[model samples]
Target: MDTVLKINNLYVGLKDMTIVKDFSLDIHKREIIGIVGESGCGKSTMLKSIVGLSDNNVSIQKGKIDFHGVSLRSMDQNQLRSIRGNKISFIFQKPDYTFDPVMKVKSQFFETVKFHTDGKANKKDCYKRSRELLEQLHFEAPDEVLESYPFELSGGMNQRIAVAMSMINEPELILADEPTSALDVSVQSQVVRTLMELRDKTGVAILMVSHNINVIASMADMVGVMYGGRMVEYGDAREVLQKSRHPYTKALLDAVPAMSQTMPESIEGAPPRFSEILQGCPFRERCPFSENKCETEPAIQGDASHWWLCHKQ
Candidate 1:
């Protein structure tokens, strides 16, 4: 598998406070990497930085973002814009805000195709392409969806359309920031399956950020557990979820509700404030297994494929 995107030692900050620290990962062709963490843990911020969409106050302080051997960190606005919606596409959490409620879906889809193609593709050409992608996403009547306004469709339908639009350019990578967070359980499954099918058919790699552990477990080939804007544990999805070594990872899994279990277990204490400089493990304060070694920053432990930040095995 070819490496589509790579990040090494990334540090992102909002004003003076660091939001993401020393984050690193490699995404390969047709692969799905899921990032799971609590709200405000920098999951959304990290995704925005990848596409050069960071807010006005936020900035990348260190590290490299390389796409297919090219450095994205050094690119200017024009350079980044050419690649953003073409080679890399972003699927925001809220479908309601992604499209114009007053505009017909077909017109909006055509506009994106035109912009990415430099106006080479006419409305007819855009319609053909959009219809094909929508059909693949399992819309029985693709024409109806194209003619309807965004306000006319259900949230799930709109989100699926958002997925289709993201694929209109045949981007090599898709950065999804909580794509299914706004939907109900059943709708969430549909959207998840649609994304998985899209990968299978188009060979597009995806970097999905979500707070739902179960959703990540259901679809991700690899998983990264984050806390305090840093990855506490990362490995093969099955390995990290079943044989997790980091206390934070264990706590996250335990917090998931199970059918046989009477009640879900919750992790004690809130996440640390980003303003306060972290000394040791970011999870030390809430960790039941914390020891003297945890007072000092723990070294990376475990093998290449599966690793964690901790003093204990």
Candidate 2:
């Protein structure tokens, strides 16, 4: 598969505090890459930076974000806007925040379609495609959904609409930040299935952030485990999840609940804050496998396909 998006040695910071450090990733066509980490580990920050959406305070200290061979970091606002939503789309964590509460859903949907299509798609065509996409995601009465305001819809419904909106443009890449984190178990499963089917039908690559290991295991072709704003382990989903190489990755897997275990165990110590700069390994304090050498920062080590940032890997 051809690579759709590439992020190399990304460093995003705010007021001298780094939120993302040395983050690198490659998303291939029709593939799904799941990033799993505790909250504030820079998963969402990285997603935003890739599309030039990071907050005002956050600066791209050092990085190269390329989409389809185009240098995103070098693009101006208008240039980035031209690529955004047309070639690369985003599914924000909160659906309500993505839309105007006062505006009718139909109007907003049409506006989005028009922005991407440059007014080429008429109202009829936009509605038809939107309804079709909604129905494909198991939405009932897609017409009613379009007429109602975003606030009128339930969380799950709005989330489905968000997914539909992201798909409306038929983009080459989709960046989703915790797309299923706000839903119930059944709804989460439904959303996952919808995303899988969307990928199958459109062959669009997806880079998703999630704290749920089960969700990542179910949908991801590749997996990246983040710790203290850096990728601790990255590899084939099955290998990284089951045959984890890094101590942090192993600890994360151990923290997940299984039927065999009567009680789920949690990783010891809280994750280091984004502003807390450490001398040694960022995870050294919490790592059970830490040795005297761990007092010094470890070099990243592994094969091309599977890698880890640890001395003991």
Candidate 3:
């Protein structure tokens, strides 16, 4: 209902290749925004920039990232350290690979809690909460789970624990990058339901990033269809899915499997690679609706809510 974050012309580049530029977004309180795109379209990179983590003093170079009316551009490590993990949390794609083989589950979990929390929560309380979270996510044997190393747990268990860690913080916003991409079909629904319930109960505005159209179609309040590094279509979920504007969006929606219809064509050509120079439209090669203007610089412009850069739109 109200804007909690605003990203204006946000630009991020590693070396000379621009991963994301002129990227803007508005996130409101109590809302979920699904970011959908092909792999290597810079979706994860953008989310990583938003999370803004650093292993010491080194941080990614980024433009405007306004959170709760405060610009994050000038904020130092100490200033940013206060906001991250507590205000915004991330659920990475691969859960099993995210943990350390050497560290016990309890050790890693405690460190995560201590990092985000204002003061150290008692070990007993942390353990109690950890157990509650594990059970909440349908895991069994609380004591065994905590004592076991991440290597000892299965993929599903690690995923459940990764989600559990995020829940421990009660963050205002959650960025889930392909949260269910690696799971089996049976487990996929369970993961989706967990996210849905989390949003419903906590009112945490979620940014669910995935390449699966069907996965996000039912869960999100708003869907942001991304192409290359830019947002191609953004609107209410039903509207964007059923009535998308950009050609890329239409193509993606068409490919979604449905019982009644024949399968649609997968988009032609591969997604573009970002190089040293700032290029024109990133989706030019794959877009059937590409025009002469596509080869030139394009500004991200449209209505306040729904936006696109394509001339045809």
Candidate 4:
């Protein structure tokens, strides 16, 4: 597979607080990587690091992020800004916050176009392009959607528009942070379908962060189970979701409510506070199969494409 992104031994910290420790992953072109973990497991923190938004007291303690093989960690703020949205974009769960009530949707669309295009862009041309993007995403009334304010449209519509606008920049990778958490099931499925279709057509790599396993199972090419700032397991969707190796991964997989009586049970115990760095396997405290070996630091081991960071593995 053609690699688009590589995160090597990436450690992100806020002063003395380490949110992501020794994280690494190679993302292939056109791949949708689903990242699952309990809240505050560094999923959001890792995404922020990728987008150059890890705020206050945070710095890359030790590691590098190579986007298309260029070291993003060393890039100055200006250089990072040049790459941020034009080559990389983020889609949040809600779009209302992104749109200003004082500004029309057309204004936001043109702003997006202006950011991605040279200053010679015309308003009429941007409108045409915006409509094309909306239509591409299967929005029926593209014109109305482009004209409506954030308060006027439904939550789903605004989210779809946000997605369309993100793609308008032609980002090489989109880090979606729970883009469907607020929608109904049908709309959630629709949004996921739209994303998958866009990837199929555009070949943009996506890292979708969501706690919802069902959503990941539906859209991800690879699945990563994160717990306590560590990637417990990452593998092909088929393998990780169906035959999870790490106990934490298995417990997460089992937690999903299934029609069958044999679904895996959710692990008990709260995720450790960010101030407390993990001593051993992060999940050892909650693992049912934990042993003495788990008390010591565990290595992330296995094949290049399929691996887990666990003592038991």
Best by TM-score: 1
Q: How large an RMSD does model 2 have?
A: 1.6
Residues 132-239, candidate 4: write the lDDT tens digits.
888899999989988888889888888888888888778889889888888888889888988998899999999988888899899999999888888889989988
Residue 279 of model 3 has an lDDT of 60
User: TM-scores of all models?
Assistant: 0.98, 0.95, 0.87, 0.95
Runs in model 4 lying further than 4 Å from the true structure:
259-264
Task: Kindly report which residue stretches of model 1 are placed more than 4 angstroms away from their true locations once superposed.
Answer: 259-262
TM-score of 1: 0.98
Best by lDDT: 1
lDDT of 3 by residue, 1-313 (tens): 6777777776666665666666677888788888899887767777777757522333355667877888876777687777766787788889854577788887777777787666566778888888887777777687899999988887767787788787777788888889889988677777887777777777888888898888888688888877767776787887778767788888787777661166777777877776735367677777787888888866656676666666674
| Cα distance off (Å), candidate 3, residue 59 | 7.1
lDDT of 2 by residue, 43-140 (tens): 99999888889888897999898887888999988888877777888998888767889988788878888887767879998888888998888888
Q: Is 1 or 3 the stronger prediction by lDDT?
A: 1
RMSD value for candidate 3: 2.9
lDDT of each: 0.92, 0.87, 0.76, 0.84
Q: Kindly report which residue stretches of model 3 are placed more than 4 angstroms away from their true locations once superposed.
A: 54-62, 117-119, 276-280, 296-302
Clashes of each: 0, 0, 0, 1
lDDT of 4 at 301: 81
Residue pairs with backbone atoms closer than 3 Å in model 1 (clashes): none
